[model samples]
Target: MRKLIVTEFISVDGIAEVERLPGVTWNDEMQRFKEDELADSGAMLLGRTTYEIFAGSWPKETGDFADRFNALPKYVASTSLKALDWKPAELLKAHCRKRSGN
Candidate 1:
């Protein structure tokens, strides 16, 4: 089975809001963390906001961070998006659920 990894940027206070993180202090660490999250992931699970932010910036950049991010298959969760202009991405269809009866 494939796995979905979610990597997020957070503040020193542990907030994952992009607007909350500023400056270049954690740039290296964030890139490293992103790489690590994608290391074993066959694909990624993301919300539309995350996808837009990533697709808008990473694909235009040249670096290790861009390489890994551009390569991974992304499954974005949304219904409003008509289509994606980016490669290596698609709409999420279904998700596995955990059962208590098992």
Candidate 2:
């Protein structure tokens, strides 16, 4: 079975807010995990908020995360982000494959 590992950027207080440099704690772990987690995935999933942030920053930066992030098939769950320029990123308006399951 595959997995839909939901990752988010949070503060030490469990506040789900975006931080610039301080939130780099899980960078290495996330990069390593995503590198392999996305390999067997048929698609990627991101909420509108997360998608916008991710779309605007990642794949544009230079690093290992960029390589891994840009490589996977991407899907954004959004009603607003109608136009995505990422080579393989797509906006999902309905249900998508659930990590090889329903």
Candidate 3:
């Protein structure tokens, strides 16, 4: 079985809203860590907002990281989105329980 690893950035006060956090910046070490993580990941599973954000940005970026991101299969879990424009992307069914046999 494949491992499902979830990574996130949160503040010391347990705030997970990365965009709203102040004084947040990216550095070479962080970039390297992200690059390595992406390289090792087989596919990406994203929510609606994150999928939209990444789809809008990564397509325009050019580099190993962007290339890897664009090339990997993307599975989006969204209830409102009817379709996906990003290549190799699929919109998961709203009822995951059926698929999971839960």
Model number with the top TM-score: 3
lDDT of 2 by residue, 4-91 (tens): 7765666677777565645466667776676776665666777777777777788678876567667777777765566877658777
TM-score (C-alpha, index-matched) for candidate 2: 0.65
Lowest lDDT block of 10, candidate 3: 93-102
Give per-residue lDDT, candidate 3, residue 99. Answer: 34
Candidate 2 — worst ten consecutive residues by lDDT sum? 93-102
Q: List the residue pairs that clash in candidate 1.
A: none
- What TM-scores do the predictions have? 0.70, 0.65, 0.81
lDDT by residue (1-102, candidate 1, tens digit) is: 655444555657776777655553656776677677767667667777888887787789887766876887777877666677667888763442334787
TM-score of 3: 0.81
lDDT (C-alpha, whole model) for all candidates: 0.70, 0.69, 0.83
Residue 61, candidate 1: Cα error in Å is 1.2
* True-vs-predicted CA distance for residue 45, candidate 2, Å: 0.3
Badly placed stretches (over 4 Å) of model 1 are 12-14, 27-31, 93-102
Two-way lDDT contest, 1 vs 2, winner:
1
TM value for model 1: 0.70
Per-residue CA lDDT of candidate 3, range 1-102, in tens? 888879887877888873664467889998889988987899999988889877877799998778888999999988788888887998885644333555
Q: Which candidate's lDDT is highest?
A: 3
